[model samples]
Target chain A: MASQTRQWLLTNPPVADIKLSGDDATFSLVTKELPPVGPNQALVKTLYLSNDPAQRTWIQKDQDPERLYLPPVQKDTPMKAFGICEVVQSEAENLKKGDLVLTEANWTEYSVQDAAALRPVQPDPEHGIKPTHFLGSLGFTGMTAYWGLVDVVRTTASDTVVVSGAAGATGSMVVQIAKHLVGCKRIIGIAGSDEKCRWVESLGADTCINYKSKSFKEDLIKATEGYVEVYYDNVGGEILDLMLTRMKRHGRIAACGAISNYNNGNEKQISNWNEVIFNRIEIRGLIVLDAMPKMGEIMETLSKGVKDGKIKMTEESETIVKSKFEDIPSTWMMLFQGGNQGKLITQLV
Target chain B: MASQTRQWLLTNPPVADIKLSGDDATFSLVTKELPPVGPNQALVKTLYLSNDPAQRTWIQKDQDPERLYLPPVQKDTPMKAFGICEVVQSEAENLKKGDLVLTEANWTEYSVQDAAALRPVQPDPEHGIKPTHFLGSLGFTGMTAYWGLVDVVRTTASDTVVVSGAAGATGSMVVQIAKHLVGCKRIIGIAGSDEKCRWVESLGADTCINYKSKSFKEDLIKATEGYVEVYYDNVGGEILDLMLTRMKRHGRIAACGAISNYNNGNEKQISNWNEVIFNRIEIRGLIVLDAMPKMGEIMETLSKGVKDGKIKMTEESETIVKSKFEDIPSTWMMLFQGGNQGKLITQLV
Candidate 1:
């Protein structure tokens, strides 16, 4: 057994703009004795960690617990993430040694967690599904995109749906779900790069525009035909402001994420706000954990869709970063730097 | 009969700011001979004009007619407003001389409109409902307040509603309705002055905060206790931004008006916008004209409430501007300048 466990701790207050020089000042790498397995608990070794934009929200400084859907990571504590772990020692009947499971763990090499809290990943070897599918398609990423489009806005075949962050995991899931499962009349995507836009279009989106392009505004206007009925907003900021102005009457916005605004307290401003009144728009913020009550129902629908060949979990564009245990902060910084594509995963093993 | 009638014309492209010096450069007062009443038309004398903040939205330049719930007033044309007009001559059987009616008449001494477009005001002497009530409570102003509360967010008695512009027409109306009609549990009001705050409380708001106060942020925090369930926003600016941070789970915003942003393009920015996602907020925009299909139903309910003395159309504090014929631009500008209180009305007669 390893005598010591290495973990990352947040030393400074939260800020998304990471200067690797100053970044080391924000997070600390420390060594601790491996926690002993106790009653109803299992000691596990983390194999992989999911890299996501929402991580920025979890460590927000001084955020009220009542206001946040997720509990904010406190200062000077271990950084939080969902990790695929292998149970090495178990004190519970359901959790056996060598069993692979998914659980919320810290930025540590080893964690002793409640065995009952672990979710057993059921990989479909026949369907070419890997264990990472639990962290990508069938995980928080897929559930968010599925329910956000279905429950948040109820995208229908009669409606035209536009998705921001269309090249990323949640955004790409939303595009595919709206196209294949919901069968929307027109599905448009907004991505950061031309290659990302093309990739989004290839995923059955009717059209995808590069927001980085000089003609993005004009291109979006032409593509939407001045009618954006449903917008699954993964990137908030200037894109959200522009969408507000062009929304058709009774427009619906599914605020899944605000990746653009998740940087160093530099959140963007929405000035064309009065258009909300003029167009009778509806903007609803979505958090996947809030959909827990409907977990079984939505998961059944998702599984059925996948089994029926209606939806693809995600393509093979997953950006998996293999990093040393001490390089956790740098691995996380890449999510904010736009240096990743699709679902960014860190192979902790 | 008066040989000629004076009317205010939009000489320049629309902008919300009205400097009496440069303002006159935007509006031109001209005299024109009365048009003969054609078949199906009635020539009427303007009685009372509703000087509203929404009038600013009507004259916005380069606005797409398809995007606006109300048609944007074009340049080189008479400015548009709802008014109490007395029929002077009628060529249609439903209309007659001396009959008081309501209409979307221009800023003119006289308007020749289709008799079918005129809504006869049924003033109830027993209840003291005057002909102006149609322009105040029973008209667009009252309907906006009533439906914006009833339909926009479906505010219930269990909800705590905070209203902005609590001293203005639609705002005060929202306060009264949320309290008396909707019977909300805790009603909070946001106003420009301590005096306006007091007036809002007098209208049955449980607490009213002056946004201009030095401790406005602390005051709002103390009042809400970080549990704002719903916000009826009429003044959209910094106040709206502040309210966003304290919203409780599943918070709803009735986007009725943005009086603060209706200036010379000095719209305030919302920085802590991620709170929407954190709190799972739902924001919906409202336009009174969009409720036309539900007009008769809502109007009937409003009239019943007034007949039952449950809701006040408005207190006697209606700011009636008895302006001289040429000073139409100055009178209309008072709505934007906060120079008048309550529902600012221009007594054209």
Candidate 2:
């Protein structure tokens, strides 16, 4: 009997200044014989992979990406990402062949992962939840929201939280968590479009402002009423400055990511940081991976919310050619252009 | 008999971008009858008047000099400041004649103040401590150091603390508090000259660096070995930027005062603010007046430390001519040029 395995490879190296384009990229898919798994490792079939803005950070070579939390992905290596996978074969003591797992699996049809790297995913079939929930609400995005709000920003029921990038995976989760769990008095969400703003409002945010509109700063101030107690910042640059000025005395800011400056060669400098001193604000950056110890509590609460219909999970999936594994580069390009809604994934099946 | 009051006034209003000259200033000693003290008020005889860098901010029409901690001195009016005074008459129940007091009195021979405005000072006659200690150690400078280190910075015993302006009143106290009270493992102090650096070391700092030296940054880095956990910032600008780069992850910065930028027309923009976000640093500006509730605790601890010899107190006093009070504008001019040391007090006796 022969074993089955699949792999994706990057054909050409990316140029520093060039924006990823059709001629600049190629993806190659290969079917090869499977190798035996070690005692602590499991063979997993990729179910759902997360396509995050952070992925773009990995593909660009010229940028000095030294994030405190996420390890930078190496060029030409199997793209490292968090995904929900089904265990096809397992020699690990903690996992079974049929068990669903969440792990840092590569962008490929099959992955051989260390059992230690695999987080066992017990599906609550009674609640009718799908495996994709593990990649969104019950996964990294959910955990990021949980730690950034609870631990980093320390948002409370009386806090007025204004979150940017408010309609995406982490932002959406943050809005829901602030509304349902934190019981924040005012939740202002800033998204790129009216559609996203409406989507955020539907997810229990008190109000949603579209950054694409010319009146972003005015709308944000009016929506927040000049009293933002906590700012969950994902989008940096001018948006950050506007938020900094409107922050209340003793306001807390959780600097989760700077998606706005991720691709730009020149990082934006905040002109009014003296506001931090004048207002006596507390601003801290956080990465969810550093808060792994609290994942169990986060998952338990999210799972209960999902079962009770208090939390609504939405994902925008963009499927690309399986053999265009090289198109991973271009697929990621679509994200920076605001081409996709939720998660960007490629299917090999 | 008609009682007389001596007062100094800023006579020559400073023009655009010109240093203040005490010449053209005015001082008057009169035999006019003393004003009657109102209920809840006391007549205080000036003992020692405080002159600080913040006074320069008050002369400017642009800056809102009324800080929560320090009220701004009105132009051409008697120079108001924190002063050590002897109570000559008191209507309020808590105070009595002959008692030493600390209050926001002016540069004058006598000031009628609300009894509520005066804080009774308990003199330590055994150690030869005088009323001036109330202006330096037990006054705003002491409270500034106490609240900034204990509350704003949230320093721990295992942390390393770096204090800029380390030989100044508040900075000196900060170094002592961090070393003696908090038991910080490493305390690096930065001052203007080798003499000031020596003064900082005498205050129990583990190491002291003269910031005026060309190799200041290198010396600072070598002193802490790249582990600065808490930064008690008094002098901002370049020194602050240097500390920002060397701060440990999750470091806390207590922005007590930006003396370096106070006279620079408030136009100095800190170029290294991105470090605040990238390193997850927590920087908070503090006004010691906002920390009044902890005054009793701080006073008791400091008094005990003084008695136990765990803390040492020193004062650099410069007595200006009472007739030369008209030269206050020039005296203040000398402050920014680092002309005076320790507590700059104008004695009207």
Highest-scoring model, lDDT = 1
Q: Find the candidate with the highest TM-score and give its number.
A: 1
lDDT (tens digit, per residue) of candidate 2 on B1-349: 1156766654433323434434543332233356888898888888767777655545554434322233445556766567778888888898988988888776677778888788888777787566777777767778888888998778889898999888776888888889898899989998888987887888888889998899987898798675678999888777887787777777888987777766554353544444565677777877776778988888788778778777675544232324254554455555566655555566653
Cα error, candidate 1, residue B252 (Å)? 0.9
Instruction: Please give the distance, in angstroms, between residue B248's alpha carbon in candidate 2 and its true position after superposition.
Output: 3.6
- Indicate which candidate wins on DockQ: 1
lDDT of 2 by residue, A50-161 (tens): 6777655555553334423345455555666677788988888888878988888767767788999988777766776667667767777788888999998889999989
The residue-by-residue lDDT of candidate 1 on A234-283, one tens digit each, is 88888988888778899999988888887748454888888898899999
TM-score between model 2 and native: 0.80
Q: A76, model 1: CA deviation in Å?
A: 1.2
List, in the given order, the native-contact fraction of each candidate: 0.75, 0.36
Candidate 2 lDDT for residue B320:
34
